[model samples]
Target: MKKKKMDDQHFDKTIKGRLENFEGPDFDPTALADLRYRLASITTAPWYARYRTELIVISALLFFTLFNVLWQSQVEVNREQSFIQVMDSLKTSQRIIIDLQQRLSALRRITSDSSNASSKPMTPMAEGKLNEVDNLLSQLLEEKGNNDPSVIALLGQVSEFLRSEPGMNGDQSPPATPLSLLPSATYHFPLPASSDSARISLDQVTLKENGGTAEAKEKHLTAAMARELKKHFQKGVGIRLGPAASLSAITYSPGPRVPSVGGGLMSDWILSPSLSMETGIIYAPRFYDREGSTMMELQNLPGVDESLGSLKEVDITSQVVQFPLNLKLYVPLSRRTEGVLGGGYSFLLYLRQDLEYGYQFNDDFDGRFQGLKSTYEQAKPRFYPGTLNLSAGTSTLLKNDARLEFSLYYQYGLGDSGLEQVKANSFGLRTAYWFTIR
Candidate 1:
């Protein structure tokens, strides 16, 4: 035990001497400070350098999307404003034309009353005033052209008056030509004279049928002449036939965007000097070629995977019939050409549709499949009932009473049409040839 104690004491001294000779690693605050500085520098680096490529691409995409949206919005707003301005201008022009027409009618009534009066012959002063008025009218006709209905009517009345004047026939003797032989150019003639002076004037005029008094006979002759003149003007009706091409789209909704081409027949009638009516029938057919890759899954087959799919191609065709009734305003642009503005209602008579789908299989189990096809037909009150249309065009009168007309028209469907919730909005070009009926 005493020797073990001496050895343990010697080992303890040896371990203590070794611990005194051994030097541990020196602690430095600067090392910890250097590490913290490096970490902070990395965090404080420029944002662009940290996320350069990703940020650039995201910013570019966002800018492009924003620019596109703003440009499209600006274009739509400008278009709407322009359309409104045009409609307002049209309304104003129409009002001015109507006012001018009323003024012309009043002037014609005054002149007719003076001419039909059975007073003493026109004095030299009065005749000179009439001559000045006539000269002024001729100058206006030369400047404004013969297309003005008011001018034409006034000229016709002047010519009729010259023929009817008692002593203007270059013969002292009573005129041999009857009043019926003169063309009636006025729309409304002076009523038969009620006073004694009017009766005496009527007595001076002779008619073929003398059964009634001079006044009655004169009235009958005037009536016949008016009817004949009306018939002559009404004969200017025209029949038009043409081909039309249209590009149709849906607005305020989603639909198939397609163009339709067709032909039509129409009849135009002159209701008045400046107003006309047209009725027509149009048949248009549209074709849609839509092809895309679609994955269609197959099921319910033994030894076949449920995940099997195929690609498909879709195609559709449709047809529509339209009937239009329109009123056109004629604004003479020249002797042979006129500008036309019109609006009307259109009836969608019928619609026929066809769809075809073809499938190409990707899996060997199914291979290629046969196509599927379908057809449908719809008529008025079931699909589209009617639409409103606006048109602007020009017509040029050609030789032999034929006319060439070219127009651009826009149509807006009043309600939904077809099997889907779709309405037709279209703009079209129409060219027509019309032959006047004699």
Candidate 2:
């Protein structure tokens, strides 16, 4: 063995010496340098570069969602603007009638006081004023269907006064009041019994013939009306509708707890800026299992006096309808977000209950048997007294006058669950999307 080892070492030395002295054909230094550079350039790519495709897909989805929200917001704004314009037009008509009433009253007083004045040659300015008033009255009378009874009566009075002028037969017209010089204050005159029945303040009505041009005054009034309407809308009552979902589990029951899922419609009525009332219905499908009592059936056996134990289990499935009513208080959390706390009651209706039983016999029995199963169903509808509900949530405003909400809730059963004296409490998370209506 030692001689073989020495021979191996001598052979390795001879090969090493021969290789060290050997020489091959010359190689290009440039080619070797290029190969080394290429090897050094290879490296693992960054995570972002490797996952660029997934990132692009996610970004596209986000962009689409944002665009859709923007479009819906624009639509809501346009609709509100259009409604404001319609209201402004109606208000303008009401203001015009009130203005005419005031001028008519002033003209009647003047006619009564000057009834005994002496006749004189009509001045050019007075004639022009009379013509203007007559033309305005004629224009109003032409549309008899649109004029109120009071307006028609005032027009008639004016016509009579014009005809009975003190100097009409002597090529003259009586002194008259200019429309612009009429009182620009509130008057207590009866209006038509309609939506515009309430008396209007003259100060609120922009005087077209006063300071600025009619067009400019009209635009200003429109902007002012819009602002007022928007303010009222913000502070006034509102309503919303949305779908809700929850994940819940039962407590203090004979059965093992399970996950319950369902969805339903929910609505809220804003009673004030920071307070609201909520009511809705939810449909829930539930499943649970409880340990069952042992039962035994056997033929004549040797030592067994009466019976033997058999494994038994019961599974329950139910469909329930929940009616919840709550009062929620809101506090602002940010520019577009709010935190809410609520307490209320939930009424439950059991639509269906299905109980399934299974039995497995022990092999100690000589009788040939495997397992037995049975199903019992109750179709009668019943009510589960009620439950007290408490919740905490956050609401985020969306672009289109809508809101998104996420909440955590707890419910304490007020009475028995009507299932073998089972009383249960439940807690879960809930989410809802809501839209606003004013």
Candidate 3:
């Protein structure tokens, strides 16, 4: 009897194993259960003693496993798509920032231009409008869209776009035809476009018209963009114009940073030396991290205001001096001109000189000075160890990778930094430069 029961159990196990093997794409547990139920019902022989619900449950479990794998595949696909979208956003924001920086720097020159080079007189409103346009351009460029491009390309696109945007005619009202767009006007510089190829130039555009037939004006805007692009390229900001095609309003060859936790060293590097100039911000200071705590605490501070140490019996919290950081980002022009922006840690060591001591005892009381020999030491005890620095260097490149770099170096204090009263906290110099042997 035992042997016969064992044989029956083995047959049932074989049948269940065969049923569990079948699966379909995007396996639906509900569908599998129904299939198993139907199969069990079709083979319902009373002597067979079919466990119909058990078969269906086992089939559903197998299908669920298959469905889980498909769901995971979809998750992986979604993650990849999300990663791509983030990277695109970073590139776009980076481009917009770079564009706006270049734009405002150009506008500053147009407004402050004292060259008296242009024959036409610039109106105050026109100048104000130029500034406004700059602001608007900057704002629009930040948002990633199909229209965004370099200033020249962007202007051309803008002119084309405005043709479909029916604008108000100074009456603070919408146009009659919403679909039919009006064209914007382009503003030339106060000076005539010069023939000299040595100088640089910049062109301003106006979205409003000074004359009729705005459609023809839109086509002319393209010409304006080309002209400006040529000028900006050859002469830099407000420099002279070269041939229209000579200068490409491009972000050089660099596209974007590689997205990795620690990206591998660049595989290929391209160098193109031109008489190119640009204006942008850079990291002038070392990013602070808690990597060097022990070494930092022992150092002295530069430009510590002594006024705070002497205010025991007086109200002089307002007299405390805090030195703010200032940075300069230069645009390079020619092999002779250069710009730099870098930040790093600085350790201000002890002053290499003796201290000059003078104190005012009271207001306008004529008193003789004396160095009283107390137990207190007269010299500074602590050495000024400066923290990380943010620096920029502009220079003219010379022979054999040697360029004379004029640096704007800022030494920021980490723990004990303060401005020395009645003294300049920072100084600029036309410093020397040494290129790294790569």
Candidate 4:
């Protein structure tokens, strides 16, 4: 036991002597460079890497919004195309009806002249038949009631043509001359063999007989025309709904121009072709960073030099929300685009505020001035009328009749931002796409 203790004591003394005699490794200048390189790699990470989650969320939202707009546009395109087709068919039918009327009128004049030339001007029944045909023709040509005429009015005139004609030889073909209504062609009607002069017709023409099909087509065309006329002449109010985004910054000389990004919904009431009134709620998350120097006085304090007021830098950051009302006018730029001019009012609602006060000479205070930050959770006057905004922009009409708009705007603060001498003015660029609700 005595021998073991002596050996342990000798071991401890040997270790102490070795420590006193040992020299540390020589200093390497490359160590400072390696430390600096490590710090730079950590601090200079790519912006996208730092905000990858935020960027993904934003991208997903944008994709959803775009998909919705495209779906709505496709629906409108289909409806508008169908409407155009109906209008075209109605126009063609109108032209055909007018042509038929003109031809009937010419035939009537020819028969009248032929009757006057014949040796018999007698028969009151024949004259009455001619007058009946004339009345039916007039009804068919009347503007307001033209499309509303019944099958009887249309086919009855053809029957009237058959009956009202003067007695004719069976072998004769009437009127070989081209009618002005159909300037491209001439029509000849054969007088059928009949013993009775009052009645003339024993087959050959199918149009007068197939009244049902003709009536159906006429009814369809008439309905379409009516709908087209209503859409064209009716005075109706319209609304437009859309999403908008803005890159905004507050206007102040002392404040650093920290960019603010926000998006929100907007709606416009189209009062006329050229004018609109707009209103909407916007979730505008804005960051305001202001940094400047202010005079600070430090009177006699322990371990502090007494001096006059010295310049000290301070920084503040505020977050705000805005709501706006606008009136706008549109001027035609092209077949599918318009130029916009607008003015508006906005109400600002401050949500939170943060301030950092730094002492310029506080390094001498043994790190006491570090981490000097104040955060205010309560908003002072919750909401106030904020700014008067002026805007200019252009809107392009999409295939679905919706519009894509790009704008530049300036907002002049109507009130202060609760920061001393700092107004809440801002300027920004905005983009929106709107669809009309009729």
- How high is each candidate's TM-score? 0.40, 0.46, 0.21, 0.53
lDDT of 2 by residue, 1-438 (tens): 999999999999999999999998689999899999999999988879833543554465446446646655666445346655755654544444555555555555555555576666666755554565665555555533345664666667667766775444444444565566655555432344333343344555555664412221333343334333433445457788766778887775544567776667788998865788999887766676665442222112112222333436566677777999999998766646778899999999987777766656656558766666666677688998888999999998765667899999998988877443466788899988776655
Top-down TM-score ranking: 4, 2, 1, 3
Prediction 4 TM-score vs. true: 0.53
The regions of model 1 sitting more than 4 angstroms off are: 1-253, 289-313, 359-383
lDDT (C-alpha, whole model) for all candidates = 0.52, 0.64, 0.33, 0.58
Give model 1 RMSD, 1 decimal. Answer: 23.4
For each candidate, C-alpha RMSD in Å?
23.4, 19.7, 35.8, 16.1
lDDT of 2 at 115: 59
TM-score of 3: 0.21
Off by over 4 Å in 3: 1-332, 351-385, 417-425, 435-438
Q: Considering only N, C-alpha and C atoms within 3 Å, which residue pairs clash in candidate 2?
A: 122-172
Model 2 reaches what TM-score against the true structure? 0.46
Error of 4 at 339 (Å): 3.1
lDDT of 2 at 163: 79
Of the candidates numbered 1 and 2, which has the greater TM-score value? 2
| Candidate 1: tens digits of C-alpha lDDT, residues 20-57 | 99999899999999999998888556868733533554
Q: Taking the tens digit of each residue's C-alpha lDDT, what string does model 4 give over 304-387?
A: 222312324344555556788999998766546779999989888776444444333354558644333333333464775588
Write the residue-wise lDDT of candidate 3 on 143-247 in tens digits: 544343344455664465334322211211221221113222232222123342221122221122223111111112233333333343333222111100001
